[model samples]
Target chain A: MKLRRSERMVVISNYLINNPYKLTSLNTFAEKYEAAKSSISEDIAIIKKAFEESGIGEIETVTGASGGVIFTPGISEEEARSVIEDLRDSMSESNRILPGGYIYLSDLLSTPRILQSVGRIIANAFKGNKIDAVMTVATKGVPLANAVANILNVPFVIVRRDLKITEGSTVSVNYASGSSDRIEKMFLSKRSLKPNSRVLIVDDFLKGGGTISGMVSLLTEFDSTLVGVAVFAENAQEKRDRMNYKSLLKVSEIDVKSNHVKVELGNIFDK
Target chain B: MKLRRSERMVVISNYLINNPYKLTSLNTFAEKYEAAKSSISEDIAIIKKAFEESGIGEIETVTGASGGVIFTPGISEEEARSVIEDLRDSMSESNRILPGGYIYLSDLLSTPRILQSVGRIIANAFKGNKIDAVMTVATKGVPLANAVANILNVPFVIVRRDLKITEGSTVSVNYASGSSDRIEKMFLSKRSLKPNSRVLIVDDFLKGGGTISGMVSLLTEFDSTLVGVAVFAENAQEKRDRMNYKSLLKVSEIDVKSNHVKVELGNIFDK
Candidate 1:
């Protein structure tokens, strides 16, 4: 499909935006759009300028026989901080506090706009690292993991607490359920992940870090390496062993009696 | 940040691509780009042409006091058919059949590119309908629902088989489990969805139709309306009560003993 230079750039930018972290040869675009290689090269240069100027992402041109352009999605630090601050404000709402001091986060995590922004922030923090996949435990963490994985253009492996017949064979690990303090099993389908994968772990909330620890152990069981960990929110009041992770929001206080909650930007922005 | 007209068009097109199904005033773009409203309007015209010509989507200008442009994502018939055909081929793999005639779908659902394409196809099927939210059962259906929600720019609600404190107060309903021939309960967080919402239900697989029914009932309980139901795949051999839905792939036969499965395109393509 031949297109004008402007229209070609629009569609090419769209393709690159959709397929982030992917390398596509300029020849592919040239042939698809019926444009010369040099024209496609010019298109990429303009797209790169627009993308970088808008802080949408960076487009890297790899030069070699097998080289191509790679688009990496990113967010400006100002935008990221503002997004987190808005989240912190929403999370501080008094009604979000449950009876047992647990702050309700389902609403926040379920929203697409919020999830997309949070995904950008977390993925940007670990931008230079080689991440093959994103990992998370079942239920709450699935969406968070999916968000990050979408930005990274990688598959997400969900570790479930209950085994289903459809999963076939799975590898299981035991972890202490921080809320219940009960030893429970978390399962990941054996075929879900590959060995030697560098995975980034993501979750909706972090408290005692027991679940993340469990996932870390499971990664070892699968011979996968942990690139890093990130969470949507963390309970700052909970005292636990130091775990290296980035969080977008920190819930410093949740007083159920007074119906008050205190929230702050998490360590994700820390230098 | 001011930009050249071509650069502005690139960024404006990117914004509309990311924020599908939502109306944005030209003034917003004009102010952001430091361009005249007429320039932004001209930019939208070119983007609309580029988007429609490329099968990316359609941009409709709503003219009124509360007027703006709304982008509705779309995929070409050829592209959609090819995507489903690819999925059918993958689903037909003999090794995908498990002991109980269940086909493993974790790998397909976890891949970002596949999920995004499937999401586009499903969302496009329900185009023109007001979809305030996407709904699905937990574990397997979360990613599919998330994908659709992302395309629609709406939040997704997860119906879970088991209750967790993190979800806070929830509304529970009972549904029959087709595989086990047993009745089971499903729960949705009370605060996750707003009342009177128009929801689109989505799932990874459709064998029983019970889970989708349960979600429909839950929607009624919340005083919400069901706009439609769409699934990634459905079992044709399994006898199920007529359920109104669209599925991308239909499994006509799953012969575990013979290690073969018959797959076909589903009703989603039906006129």
Candidate 2:
């Protein structure tokens, strides 16, 4: 339906925000709102300014017969640091320390608000990379991967620890178990990922780095390339394989005897 | 940042869309945007009209000493039907059939675009219910639950088929397995959910309804109330105990030998 300029601007802003990284011709919006293409272009100009100024994201306009606009979601450094600091404070609570030095993170991972903010921060940290999919292990990593995938506007593939009949054909790999010295297997559906796609690996926690390394091998088997690795939190005490990665929070200390846990901003903020 | 009326409206629209089911007083926006309270109120008025006109959602204004506006995400019936119809067509593709009459839905579930639409549709169906969390079984149902919980702005609890030490203490329940006639156990972390929370159960597909039932019983152990149940699709041929729930698609027929499958809009659109 036709609307006033202000109302039309509001609706178009909603569309761009929801359909980030998508290219829509100005004519499409013009026809949908029953306005001139020139008017639609003007509305986008204003939206671009608003989105950039607020650090919500960046809007790129393509100029061609088939071009429109694309939104790359971003978070300001200030906002990102503030969000991670708040998470660090929550992670430091002594009550979150459980047996085996595991910090309880399920509550933070499952909450929508925290998940969305973490998603934006992670996605922004990987800016300028052409990522086609987000990869994570089953169970704990699903929501974190989902959140980041939602922001990147890409499909996410889950690597499972067990084989299921519903997955049809599958690809399997083995990695060293962190807690136990035994080797463990991980599986991914053959069709879940496409060959030659660039993938960003994400996880809820980083301990031995075994799981992430296992996923890296799976990527090679799929004939895909790894864009980078990101984790929600990392255990600094654990000595693992040295790998380049970014994390939102670092568990600097976890003393089970004293029931003490220390948390700080992760490598994502490191220059 | 201070902005013009049009640009400010664009930013405010972004805030409301990102933060649905949340209340923010005009003073907050007034202070942030460096605009008068009256101007901020006017911005919300225009936004409400635009949002309703486009069927994005409803904006409720709670007026009092400590009140502001709340956005309830919504989808128009016409749009919802169109989306469901498209999914029905995609589900009918014969290649989706597996050896044992299972449907391959990982592609659809993993895609952010489709999951977001399904989330809006499912969350909209249970609009009036006070949902404290979304519940589902692990491996397959995690993304579906995450989608719904994201829309509803609540945490989600996942019931696992196997025990993990990372979950700390958990409550386990037994249910009849659909594939195998043997009883299977499912577990939920003790601290993941609080007592007396109202939850909505979501899953990728419904066959024997055993898994959903398992989760429902698990809820009782936690002293949580069931708000409702929704599924992405249901198997029409499966003979199972009767249960009340909403489904987006129905697999009317699946012939593995002929490599044919029939799908149609589910009971979600039924009057």
Candidate 3:
């Protein structure tokens, strides 16, 4: 794989962008590029210099023979917005997704493009808001929380439906819901969220505002401020309460029982 | 609010890099920057052009007043490795993260920084391969799957422990565990994975390889090939039939009952 400099950069950038997780050894790069180890090292130096000079990325190298290279974490606001717009289009195809009264976000959530796009958009939305932490309910929300937290360089806290031994001394809040007659309790560690801190709540779907509302209460219990709530999709025509909300797709529910569904991109520009 | 061009790019790139999920509007950008809408637009055009010309990134803009910019989802190998090395240092601290009798990666999995770092590492490991999908079991594995899937632009399939969905039938397999006498059942959707596709298997921790071994069986059922198996942490001293695995961290078990925790960086490059 003796690639030209431009070709090498494309290959190298795509590799770093695609991986985003582990540091690679020089040997690993040499192996991937199928070039001499020295050449690979030189290419990496060039790439690192290019990244530093451009101010678009950073390269970190581990000392010793076992050490490798990594791309510093980042994406631009423009890039973030493009991702959301694509999702907005995808969510607009409601007729195709609503199967048996449930919006099949499973497919969308499971897809990387949509997840990466939505993740960046939300991160951009919360950019420079002095966000102390990113919070989400357990299960599906984990992915969204992880995406936003990564770019922000902050901790992500998960509010669990059931308490685990690992979390230790949890605080709980109850929410009223249709499926369960009794109140549903969501829990987070007493030490998980800081007091008077700015928090961004993220979730995969918002059927009713109940779950998010409970999370707000939980955050308040810790004396944290709710900066805003962002959802992958929201049923806005149903008129859910509370201000400061953004959604990639707004689902103006037509008829859930008849398996009828309609969706549109939300007012993304609306502050 | 009078930020320099480089400052604006840094802020914008940092936000997009952190979030990695959705699209943001130009209006949103204007609001974030508090700059003149025209100025913001010009800055964005310059940034986008720079990214494209350098072959380092792609910036997409949507037309009309509601539209804004987005970073085309991309990264380089050097960038990926650079981030992973930084993460390795951050995670090197023994005090910041509390120790337990058993390695509780639940915290790391739930936490965004660790998860994002892990995601980039795994993503780099499998970059440019014919990986059609990413697979992991429920709970802890979801976040990692999401991270890897996001970078790879693929789908992440979750294998459930139980048949919670009454509507759909599942394909199940049995696994022998190091802890329990009984064989555990791992369920996946019949349609979730296609035939002869390359799959990447990831998990929060690898103890006995029972789960990974089970997932291999499920993949076999669908005629899919195992592109790779990665673990956030691997208890390597405890030997098993399974070999050739990639891990972010390595733990040589200090006996199942001892109060010793020996944690070191996994030999990810050993592969």
Q: Write candidate 1's Cα lDDT for B1-271 as tens digits.
A: 8998888889998999989988999888989999999989998998899999999999999998789999999999999999999999999889999898899999999999999999999999998898899999998999999999999999999999998887899999998888648999999999899999999999988887888888999998899999999999998877777779998999999888999999999999999
| Best candidate (score: DockQ) | 2
What are the iRMS values of all candidates?
Answer: 0.7, 0.8, 9.1
Candidate 3 lDDT tens digits, A101-147:
55555566777656655665776666547787888987778777877
Worst 10 residues of 3 chain B by lDDT: B92-101
Writing each residue's lDDT as its tens digit, candidate 3 over B8-49 gives 544455445434434687777677667778877776666555
Candidate 3 residue runs with Cα over 4 Å from true position: A1-85, A92-100, A166-169, A189-192, A237-244, A254-259, B1-100, B110-117, B162-170, B176-178, B189-192, B237-243, B254-259
Candidate structures ordered by DockQ, highest first: 2, 1, 3
CAPRI classification of candidate 3: incorrect
All candidates in order of lDDT, best leading: 2, 1, 3
Docking category of candidate 2: high
Candidate 2: tens digits of C-alpha lDDT, residues B1-271: 7899999999999999999899999999999999999999999999999999999999999999899999999999999999999998998888888888888999999999899899999999999999999999997898999999888999999889999988889999999888549899999999999999999999999999889889999999999999999999999888888789999999988999999999988999888
Model 1's DockQ score: 0.87
What is the per-residue lDDT of model 2 for residues A173-207, given as tens digits with 9 covering 90 to 100? 99988954879999999999999999999999999
Retained native contacts per candidate, as fractions? 0.80, 0.90, 0.34
lDDT against the true structure, each candidate: 0.92, 0.93, 0.68
User: Who is ahead in lDDT, 1 or 2?
Assistant: 2
Q: DockQ for each of the predicted structures, in order?
A: 0.87, 0.89, 0.17
